[model samples]
Target: MAKTIAVEYRVHDGPDALAHAAAEHFLEQAQKSVAAKGKARIAVSGGSTPKRTFELLANPKEKFLQAMPWEKLELYFVDERTVPPTDKDSNYRMTREAMLDKVPLKPEQVFRIKGELPPEEAAARYESTLRNQFKLEGAEVPRFDVLALGMGDDGHTASIFPHTAGIHELARLVYANQVPQKDTWRVTLTWPVIIQAGEVFFLIGGKDKADPLHRVLQGQYDPETLPSQLIQPKNGKLLFLLDKDAAALLPAPDASGKGKLEIQR
Candidate 1:
C-alpha cells in the first residue's frame, strides 16, 4: 500500500521572508540529523529562490551559521543541467557561489553530478555514488535527511519536466531525461528516490507560479501535466513553503492567518 501523503503549507509575505523561514527550517533539520546520526545528507535543487536561502545559510555572521554542523553536512544536487560546473547555467556553480564556497564543508562532502558527461553516464555514475554512500540495495532508496526543491513556472521540479519520461520512472533511483523542447538533457534523481526522503520542501515564489501552485496544491493529482504534484513523500513530511505571490491563488486563509490546507492521498 502506498503511504499516505499529508501536505502542510506556510505562506510568507514575500520571497525574502520565505527564504528566512526556509533557512530556519533547514538549520533545524540539519542540527537534528547531526545530533541523532552524526551527519546530515541534503539534496538541493537549483533556482533563483533557493539562492536566497543558501546565502542566509552561508552568512558567517548569521546566528544560525554560528552553530551549524557544517562539517557533518553532506551536500548533493537533486538534478543538474548538462553543463560543466563552471558554466553559467550550472547548478553546482550556482550553489557553490551561493553557499558551499562560503561554508566549511569539505570538498569531498559536496557531491555534484558531472553534467559535462553524457547524460546516461552521469546518471548511472551518480546512482552508484548514492548507493555506495547510503549502502543501498537493489530495491532500497536512499533517504535524504533534507530534500530542498524549487518549482518552475511550468510546475516541474528537479528536472522532472511535464510529460517527460523521468516522471514515469518507477525503478531507477536516477534518470537521464531528454527535454527536446529546450534541446537539453538533464540528469535527475527520480521520484522513486525523492519520495522516500526524511523531509521534502518546495520553495515556490513569484506570481508566475500562482496558477500552477494552485492546481498542484488544490487541484487534481496529475503528475504528467504537473510534475510537481509527483512530490509525495512516503515516509516524511511534505511542506509547501510559498511566498505571498505564489500562494495568491490558493484558498484564502481562515481566522488564524495561515492558509493551512491538508491533502491526503
Candidate 2:
C-alpha cells in the first residue's frame, strides 16, 4: 500500500511561542472537525513539551475559553504509565491538572486508560472504550481528528519505545509495551491506530531533542531503531512543530528562514 506523506514544519522562536503555535493549530483543527462532524476526537501525548500547550488551551487569555468548543471535544490519552491515574507520573493526571479540569467536558466525554489495572487489561479496556464511543464498526480503527504526539530524545512516541513490541505491532490497535530497561510497562495506541488519524502533530522542543529530531527527519526509515520515524498518516496530515533550539541541527533554511517542511510521496 503506497502512501504519500506530507509533512509541515513550523519553527518558533522559543518554547512558549512553540506552545502557542501548537495550541492555535489544535484549535483550528478541532473547530474544523467539530463543524464537519459535530464533534472532535483528539488523542494527546504526555511530556514536558506538551504541558505548556495544554495549559495554554485551558487558560482564558485571548478568549481561548470562549473560542474553543470544549463540549464537542472528546479527549483521550495516546499512552499512559502503568501507575494509577492519581500518580504524579500519570498522563491523565497531568492532563487533568493542565487542561481537562478547566475544560467544559463531562466525565463521560473523557476516556482514560485504567493504569492501575494490569497493562494488558488496561489496553483492552481502552480499546473497548474507543470502539463504543466512536461507534466503530467491525475492523474499523478509531480515526481521531487530531493526534498530538511528543517525541522523546530517543525518537520514541506514545510509549512506542525504540525496538519495543509496540513498534512491531500491526494487528492490534492498542497494547501494553514493556521496556525491560526500565523494568516497567505502558499502555499505548499501536501504530495501526495512530496512522488512522486525520491529523498527527508532533510537538517537540529543546536542544536535547535536536539530535533525535534530525535523525527522525533525515535518517533512514527504521521504526525499530527510531519509533517516531514510523508515523506516516495514510490519508492525513503530519505536522512537526519545533522550537528554534530543536530545529538548530537541521540544514540551513532558505531566505524566508522557515525550516524544511518535506513531503515524501
Candidate 3:
C-alpha cells in the first residue's frame, strides 16, 4: 500500500546557489553516514546540475574538498548511458573530469557501471558487484547511505522513462532499459533499489522542468506518465533542491526558502 511521503524542498536563488546547496547537503549526508558506520556508500546521478555540484565538491578553493572524508566514502553511479567511459555522454567520464581526478578518493573507491559492455552484461555485472560489496546472501537489497537523483524535463528520473519496462522492474537491483524516446540503452539502479536508500534527493533546475515537476509532485499518482513519482523513499521523506526557475509553479517557500508538501506514494 502507498503511504504518505513528506516532500520537502529548498528553493535557491539561482543555479549557482542551488549547486552550492546540493554540495553542502552531499557533504552533510556523507558525514552523517560515516559517523553512523565506518564508511558511507553514496550513489549519484549525472546531469548538468549534478555536474556543477561535483565541480564544487572537487574544487580545492571550496570547503568540501578540505572537509570531505574521502577515504571513508564509496561512490557508485545511479545510472549510466550505454557508451564507453571515454564518450561524451558517459556519466563516468563526466564524474571523472569534474570530481574524481581532483578528489583524494582512490580508483577502487569508485564503482562505475561498465557502459562499454553490452547493456544486459553491464547491468548484470553491476548487480553482482553490489551483492558482493553489500554481502547480500539472498534477495536482500543494498541500502545506499545517500542517493542523488535528477529529474528530466519529461518527468523521468534515473533513466526510468515514462511507460518503459524499467518502471515495472521490481525483482532486480539493476536494469538495462531501452529508452525508445532517446533511442539508446541505459543501465540504471531499479526503483526498488533507489527507494531503499537511506537518503534520496533530486536536484532540478531550469524553467523547462517547471510543468513536469508540478505534475510529478501535485498531480495524481500516475507512474506511467510521470516516472519521477515512483521515487517515494521507504523512509517516508523526499527532498528536492531546486532553483527559482524550476520551483516557479510549486508553492512559494517561506522566508528561509523552505517548502513542504505531502503526497501518497
Candidate 4:
C-alpha cells in the first residue's frame, strides 16, 4: 500500500454535514472498540472541521451523536494552541465547549494541554501524561485506537508547520514551535508518536482545503513539505475522510484494493 486512503463522500454540499458524519463515524468506531476491550483511546485534531465535528458530537441526544459509550472512552488533543485553556484561542476550550464537558468520561481520562505553563514545561508535562497512559518512554509512540487530524491550507497538520525544528523533535511527547507571524508557539505530538497510532483519520473538507488535500494524497509523503504525509499506522490503518472538493484532484484506485478506498476524482 502507498500508505493513505479515503472514506465515503456523504456529500452535504457543506462542511457541517461532512463534519457531523465524520464525528459520528469516530464515535461509532470507538464504541465498538471500547465495548470489546473495556476502554477506548483517541487523539483528536485541532481545526475548523473537527471543531464543528466536536460540536455535533457534544449533543449525544442527536441522531448520529446518540448512544455513545462515553464512560468507556478517553480523549486526547492532537495539538494545543499554546495559550491558557480559557483564552479564546485555546484548543482545550473549543473541545470543552464542544464535547468534553458533555461526556461522562471521568476527569482523569480527559487530558487537557497545560498551555498556561512555559512551552517546554507544558510539553514535558504532556509527555509525562502520555507516558503514564501509553506505558511508553518519551521516545516511543503511543498506539491509540483512533487519531483524528485536520489539514491546513499551508499543508500542515497538528502544530507541525512547514520547515521547523518541531518536525525534527525526537523526544518530549510534546514540543514548542516558534514559528513567526502566527502564535509564537504550539504543543504537538511528534510524527514518530502520531504515526504509531493504530488508526489515523484526517477530517478534510471545504473548497479552500482542496489544494493541500491533493498534495497530501497525490504528492510526496514528505514531512518537510506536508507534515500530514508522515502520519501512517505502523501496523494498523490510515483513513482520510474528505468531501468532494477535497477529493477532486486525487487519483482513484480499483475495486480490488480491499484495504483502501480510493475516491476517483
Choose the strongest candidate by TM-score.
Answer: 3
Better of 1 and 4 by lDDT: 1
lDDT (CA) per prediction: 0.88, 0.87, 0.96, 0.74
Best by lDDT: 3
Ranking by lDDT: 3, 1, 2, 4
lDDT of 3 by residue, 1-265 (tens): 7599999999999999999999999999999999999899999999999999999999989999999999999999999999999999999999999999999999999999999999999999999999999999789999999999999988999999998999999999999999999999999999999999999999999999999999999998799989999998999999999999999999999999999999976
Model 2 agreement with the true structure over 214-253: per-residue lDDT tens digits: 8888877777888988898877468888888998888766
What's each prediction's clash count?
Answer: 0, 0, 0, 0
Candidates' TM-scores?
0.95, 0.95, 0.99, 0.87
Regions of candidate 4 where Cα sits further than 4 Å from its true position: 1-12, 64-66, 137-139, 181-183, 252-265
Score candidate 4 by lDDT. 0.74
How many backbone clashes are present in model 1? 0
RMSD of each: 1.6, 1.7, 0.7, 3.8
Candidate 4 lDDT by residue in tens digits, 1-265:
3433454333334676678778778878888788778888988877678878887777756764456777777889888977889998898888887777776767888988798999888888888888888788635767778888888888888898988787888765778777664848888888777877767777888787888877766675677878776665565456777676776665543353112444222
Model 4 is weakest, by summed lDDT over 10 consecutive residues, at: 256-265
